[model samples]
Target: MKEKRYIMMVGAVDDQLSQVRASLTETMNQKNVITQWILSRDGIDAIGKVDNQKFDAMIIDAEAPRVLNADFLNGIGRHRNTNDCNIFVMSTQDQEQLHPNLQKYAFLQKPLQTEILLQGLSEALSQNLKPSMVEKFSVDVRVINALIKATMMVCQNYGLDQVDMEKPTPKLLELPWQGQSGAYLDIRSQVFSGGLILSFEKNVFLKIVSEMLGEPFTEIKPEISDAIGEISNIILGNAKSEFTSYGVEMTLPKILSLGQTIDQPAGSVSMLITFGTPMGKFFLEIIAHPRK
Candidate 1:
């Protein structure tokens, strides 16, 4: 199944974003893929959203607030959450006004042209459609990007610094019933159905629950478990909206107790993505099966 594409407009005029949205809607639907667009007036929030959610294309304005510095523009290129983003800068002024860090990227002259915007988006979406091999699952890069973005965003939101993403590894064996705590959210579509799991080591889980509640205690209280579940919910919840736009619906997240494991369906490919944070290291896994 063709995954949906999401487009974001940062610091763009309302009319410009609207026109781009219309163009993307028409083009993507004709390809039998759902498309959605989101707009942000502030560049910082826009960056955060882009970091937390995967977008096939991002149209950013040169004059957007809080984006005047070269360092900030550079950060966008370096951030793992956005490094894969197909960025297109939009400017009302001439090229001289663009930050030095943004000079290498493609640009869109404002007042935006529908044809140009559609063309750029079409190209960006095409780039994302190329399939990648991750063990047995022919996973889409957008799926991996979305999961990574959500993990990084949660770490940032919790004041965790220097978050690191480890390389994803394929899981061919059954998940062990080790003493681990986690949460899972099940997602379903006519084309695919599976679940996303966020599991943590004992110490890491405690730290996350403690910091989230702004207290310093270490025990898996019922509330602590609930807190962990909420964190998983937030991560999946953020991704859920993105998937929904693409025609997939996700159900309420469920918590897993110590030593519990969710089994993947037959023929599904499972992969683990580990994240290192100030608190500790945890992993998020996607075990999915494609429905022909």
Candidate 2:
């Protein structure tokens, strides 16, 4: 069920990204993943694409429309950070030419070898570790990273400056969560299918919604009741780019009103992740019904 992934190539030669695409296509089938390739004319065009769309990953040429600089590379890296998209740089020059400020990406030498490129891509995923407990708990780290990054970005974008993630705990369908209002998106893919919920306390939810809508609210008004659902949609949408590798699909999120509660989602497995917010804490619960 893997979805086609989009890749952006900045300042690349015509054949550069295509060959990488071919190599990826050949290798991914063995792993049940598929990717779609997009070539950027140069740095300028690449910037536009990078800003407007969600690319699973990016490859940049040292030429960078001739050559790259610290400022430009850092700029792109900052933008890509929200979604944790990997960046690979292609260069025929010395490593010194790369920006020291940018360390989160991979540097590939020219005379590109498909094996090296693939290896770099693989290692990039492993480069950063997830929250210690979640890392050890989840069987798949990629999905965990994708979802966590999306959660942090969404909250931060909504004005939560320092969101802290907590370890995931096993969830029981029969148990209730501690949040006042919440929403969850039901996800389905080759690996698992279940509801992914983000629950928040009454104050945190209201404050977040207030920041979101530029209005203050002490209760869930008709105008603000859908805020949780919208937040859930954004989280899944951002993660969907990475989920493409899993061929994942999701349904519109359902809201958990302040008074309403559920024991668990319709899946057999559930893992709960917590994020600390200014007003209080919000929870991210991943409930999965693993498919054989």
* Per-prediction tally of clashes: 0, 4
Candidate 1: which pairs clash?
none
Ten contiguous residues with the weakest lDDT in model 2: 131-140
What lDDT score belongs to each candidate, Candidate 1 first? 0.66, 0.64
TM-score of each: 0.51, 0.51
Model 2 spans > 4 angstroms off: 1-139, 258-267, 290-292
RMSD of each: 13.9, 13.9
Q: Please tell me which predicted candidate would have the highest lDDT against the true structure.
A: 1
What is the number of residue pairs that collide in model 2? 4
Give the alpha carbon lDDT tens digit for every residue of 154-199 in model 2: 8888778888765557767667765988876676655445667788
Give lDDT tens digits, candidate 1, residues 1-292.
7568777777755765677677767766666677777787766777677667777777778888877655467677777766787887777764447777775566555655444456556656655353431122233334444566677777667656677776556665376422267777776653346777778776677766677888976777765666767887777677665565556767676877665667766777666767777667788777777433
